[model samples]
Target: MKTVLKALVLLVVVVAVLAVLVFTWIGSRGISARDDPSGLETVVARTMRRLAIPRGDRNRQNPVPATEEVLAAGRAHYADHCAACHANDGSGETQIGLGLYPKPPDMRLSATQSLTDGELFYLIENGVRLTGMPGWSTGTPEGEEASWHLVHFIRHLPEITQAELELMQEMNPRPPAEIRQQIEAERFLQGGDPPPSAPHAH
Candidate 1:
């Protein structure tokens, strides 16, 4: 009995000492975890999974096949709301996005472990409760349509080239038909000038 009691006392002392050491280390130095893009991405991605509803068919949906009409609407909405943080090409917000403590997601080329249309809608319209993504929908077509348009734009973003991106931005910046007509005229003129069989620099 005495031996058992001594062993218990020794174990308690060891635990107390270890606890004090941990407390001292934490209180004196503190634990500021990594907050870089990668670190923030990791924490957010994990939290999203824990909180958001899981998609049963994540393997099937690519989230990038969008129609041209939807693409157009999305581009416009993206420019107005999402572009500042997500960037014009989903390349992530260089200036505004960086200001976040858990920085805004790059959503550019980083494959979201697997986010679906519904999950994305929930996050965007309702928000993740605490994450930086804010809900902007007022439950109207103009509002909801604009939000979905941004989603469609994001779905097919990776394949778009830098030049195409510039073109899209240019077209979306102005009233639709006027810019479309001008762009079409330019295309028609360019097509008239047949490509020399070989590449040349101006």
Candidate 2:
């Protein structure tokens, strides 16, 4: 009993020391979303994420079957909702994605593809803390089914075709400025006034 108590005390002391060191490092470097995480930080974050998932959830299988129709639905959903951050090719190269701290992963890569269907679904539903991802759960069976469909779509990302990418591009949401530009261009082509010039900064 005395030995167990000593071991527990030692563990607490070690953890406290590590915490202090980590905070000191952070204080010295300061926090910036622009900076990429270090190798150690990446490993720790991944480890924590893995540990946080319930075993049952990690082992659960995807209930939604991978069908052409299902895939098409997933593709459309991704293009409309996820493409802003994840990109049509799952490359995570969009301006918003690039600006995020730790940025989105390239979903076609092994780091993302290697995750089990359940893990992917859980992440989609629950989201990661302290990251750009948000929980998409709607607390409905339909919502869960959609998330399952997305898992299959994520699996298919590596094999996504160019035609499909073009389709998704058309479906991606355009910014208001881009929409205005398109409208102006269309008007000009119809012999209307040209687009207004940008105002100069004072």
Candidate 1 ranges with C-alpha deviation above 4 Å: 1-34, 37-41, 48-50, 54-65, 168-202
Per-residue alpha-carbon lDDT of model 2 for 8-76, expressed as tens digits?
Answer: 999999999999999999998888776778889888999999999999999989998899999999999
Count the clashes in each prediction. 2, 0
Residues 1-202 of candidate 1 have per-residue lDDT tens digits of 9999999999999999999999997687644332454567677776765465555522223244467877877776776677666677776655766765456665755554246666555556665554466778788867666666666677667776777577656543446788767756765576544343434333
Candidate 1's displacement at residue 57, Å, is 13
lDDT of 2 at 148: 93
In candidate 1, the residue pairs with backbone N, CA or C atoms under 3 Å apart (3 or more residues apart, or in different chains) clash, namely 64-155, 74-149
Root mean square deviation (Cα) for candidate 1: 12.7
- Could you tell me which 10 consecutive residues in candidate 2 have the lowest summed lDDT? 193-202
lDDT score, residue 130, model 2?
Answer: 94
